[model samples]
Target: MKDRGHVSTTQTLDLNDAGKIIDAGIAEAERIGNPSNIAGVDAGGCLLAFARMDDAWRGSVDIAISKAWTARAFDVETKALAKLAQPGADFYGIHASNDGKVMIFAGGVPIKEGETVIGAVGVSGGTGKQDQGVAEAAAQAFARG
Candidate 1:
């Protein structure tokens, strides 16, 4: 049999990784004295793990999920999309084009290993910067572990 030199295999984010991410987000949220919804999604934009803190905004659950989905699906931090989607920008109206599932604001970060994005973490219920802070904490913790 002729041996193939190499095969491409996609990296996956399992439950444990998701838990670590959630833990980090929780710690940050507690430190900030706020409750928020956190989301973890696989490279394919499917939810792997999720958590909504007590008293988190009831309206932000779907937004949190959409943030992670947007990050994983586009391999771009959702906050960055805000600028890209501005009028006259290359990706203008991109959010509306995605069936309104995309969230063009802070709180979504693509988790990457090397050059490959394995997953993403999203946070909601606080200010945009606050949400981003918690999400960044989650991504950093996941990367370290």
Candidate 2:
């Protein structure tokens, strides 16, 4: 028998990790004094976990989840997709074509470890920049762990 070197693999986010991401997002929202809704989803666009602040807008829950779904499904930030809707772009209808799962707006970011996409986190119920900030904070939290 020949000896073989050890193989290494990258870490990926599963359902439990996705839940942690959602928690981090909620915490970020609180820290920023922006009560909002947050959601996490797996790479396949399946919902892993979600949270809505006590005073968050009722509709933000659905929007946050949809944002996460969109990011996971596309493997990119929803904001980037939103940018593709420029006047001459061919994807102008993409935002409305995902059957309500695609929210082509800021606030959704994919959770990636190197090239491996684990899942995504999304925040809503604030300005676009505020939402993006919350999502970024959550992503940073997940990366730290």
Candidate 3:
């Protein structure tokens, strides 16, 4: 144990920050007139906080969480994946290869602290653009606070 190499490190979100992200997402969803399902996840793609607005679709729960997880895991918005997964692209057929966990839709945004991506938030239960906007609002809230 005398010759230790460099150690790796990463930032992760705690419950407080995750809750903030969720709250902001909820507010955004309400403002947009589209009650949504929202989720927050740490750097390792573990769910930290979640919110399902009243009358939200029951099926959107998993999709929202998966959007956050996928964003954190890949450091890319879920919707952007759609472009990369198109036919003849490098990630073509990637959708079916991930056990159906991947969500290539607009509803995920990374939570960054400075240049480091600490976690992510995802939103669903509305149009893709609406979902993406809500997620972005959540991320901005986390950044500001």
Number of the top lDDT candidate:
1
* Alpha-carbon RMSD of each model: 1.9, 3.9, 2.1
Model 1 Cα lDDT, one tens digit per residue, 34-137: 89999999878899999999999998999999999999889999889878988999888888867898999999999998899999999999999999999999
TM-score to true structure, per model = 0.93, 0.86, 0.92
Pairs that collide in candidate 3 are: none
Each prediction's number of clashing residue pairs: 0, 0, 0
Please estimate how well model 3 matches the true structure, expressed as its whole-model Cα lDDT.
Answer: 0.89
What is candidate 2's CA lDDT for residue 136? 89
In model 1, the runs with Cα more than 4 Å from the true position are 1-7
Best by TM-score: 1
**Which scores better on lDDT, 2 or 3?**
3
lDDT score at residue 102, model 1, on the 0-100 scale: 91
Ten-residue stretch with the least lDDT total in model 2? 3-12
lDDT of each: 0.92, 0.84, 0.89
